[model samples]
Target: MEIYNNHKRLYIAALLLFLALTLYAALIPAYKAQNDNAPLPNSKPLSEQEALGKAVFVKEGCVACHTQQVRNVEMDKFWGERPSVASDYARNKRPDIWRNTANLMGSERTGPDLTNIGKRQPGKEWHLIHLFQPRSVVAQSIMPAYPWLFEIKERAAAADVTVQVPEEYRKNIKGDIVATEDALNLVAYLQSLKQVSLPDGRPVPKFLYPKQSTPDLKGMGTQTEDAGLDGASLYAANCQACHQQNGEGLPGAFPALKGSSIVTDADPKALITVIMKGYNGRVKEGFAEMPPIGVNNNLKPEEITAIINHERTSWGNNASKVTVDEVKAVLAEIGK
Candidate 1:
């Protein structure tokens, strides 16, 4: 009761309490985190090139859309083998002086999680082309292209790394699309995002979506001689993501598969090759390049045949069905 009359004493007490809370809540935790000794297995510090690439990634605001941390929830398993622990971020830090969000563990995930992008998509060529034009590989992708990070040269020099851009996409540019040092560094950083496995005794969380174990649709077998391939189901499951259910494809990004010449072609050679090895931009206008679904997605010969048949027969196209033997022969000839 007497303290109520002592304003200065009360003010001093409140200030001391605030400082104590600040120390308990912030400083202590930061100090413990900085001193953590247990890091994830096989996790390495960034190389010089990768560090530069990280700067480029931060400069480009990549963290705004792509999250680097994988949460413990089951749904987040798609991004990494296991949930990210404190040790996973131990090696990720800015210098002592620079302290603007040192951990690039972004909040919003407008783009897919980049925590394990290095494992998901590792091809240097793919990253280069995708950076040059997101639409080139993913026609419907809204990711901004960083063309300014590349240089257009009349011809590639001995040291220049050229990417596969459709002629039309490169129109009015005098030279080939070559990766700049920044671009190379940026890709290096992207490629360094593999998820490190948790140390022993830490249980890996179960996947939210159980892996499919049963045999795929009738025609989904990888064997060359297997019959009863389910073309419709296979197409629905795999191709429909980009080609659309109706086979119309996304205009300007993905070509119309329903009435496309390649789909209706009698030979079926091109279709098989496209699915197996992937196709880069060929024309000067429209239709971004198609990544090799078979290889990247691990599609077998029978699966490829089923997809070809589905595209040929569906959407009023009257092309003949392809056999597994034919697909196998093509795969052999093309050395897939």
Candidate 2:
């Protein structure tokens, strides 16, 4: 009886060991196959600056909290997409970052999924502020403050805004460079996000971004409020070539106007000024500056207002419109 029991125990252990080896052998290739693609779902062409930021991201241990991969489950919930392919990161990348398997899949979602976060907000200013003071915009954000990332410096009161460097943080009168140049690299990287819906036949509109909408016509369309219609139309004609029909702007180059406090919720005076004066100076990533459109004296005021109204209402934001008189004031302020 004792001999028979020992033999039975040995047989059971051997069977279990065999099954475990089979499972491991099966999963090993599957893991290699997925990781073989490296940096999955990241399709954008990365510039040198973006690549620098990516290195920082890896070094900063941000990968532990935030993930770049979008799983089938996660991709569908956030913005409907699919499992990533290895080829997405092949260009401008080495050692392929296809990380959907180990660090990303098993990690906790402490921070938001970074798969499409690059352009979620668009402007560098917004990122600067959030980094400067997290609670300022997102009340409950747990992300660490990165004030060291900004450079604070004194800037001259130039009607030409080029004097606004450490341009990432402070606007208007500059103080000191708040964040380091490295910060801007990360901002550039984050602003690179784009939606995958474009792969299909569906075109996305700026107004259709899935954010809570807010609108109030109670005190809108005054003479000062309606100033940018023609400017808007002009922008639609000339600027849309790069900024795109959607307000989000281009992934890496054009900064967005949708949620730009400068455009949507800031002083109406600034909005008129930018349209009539046509802004220069880099707002986001590129060293390339915006050419002035305010040079068109022949344009009508009401038309500019219509454009501003469309933009304010187009993005999921609600605000009063700029009027003709307001445009004139901004025009006068800029001496145009």
Candidate 1 lDDT: 0.77
> Residue 135 lDDT in model 1?
71
Query: What does candidate 1's lDDT look like per residue over 1-336, in tens digits?
Result: 777799998889899999999999999998887887566778999999998899899889999998998887756765776777778888877746755545799999998889887865655666777788877556567899999989988899988877766555666777778899999999999989887777689777654555454364455554443356688888875577456677876544456788889999989888888887777665345445665667645567777888888899999999888787788898999987
> Which candidate has the highest TM-score of all?
1
Candidate 1's TM-score reads 0.64
Per-residue lDDT for 215 in model 2? 43
Model 2 lDDT per residue over 258-313, tens place:
78787786467776666655665664455234434444322345555666677777
- Per-candidate TM-scores read 0.64, 0.42
Q: Residue 45 of candidate 1: its Cα lDDT?
A: 92
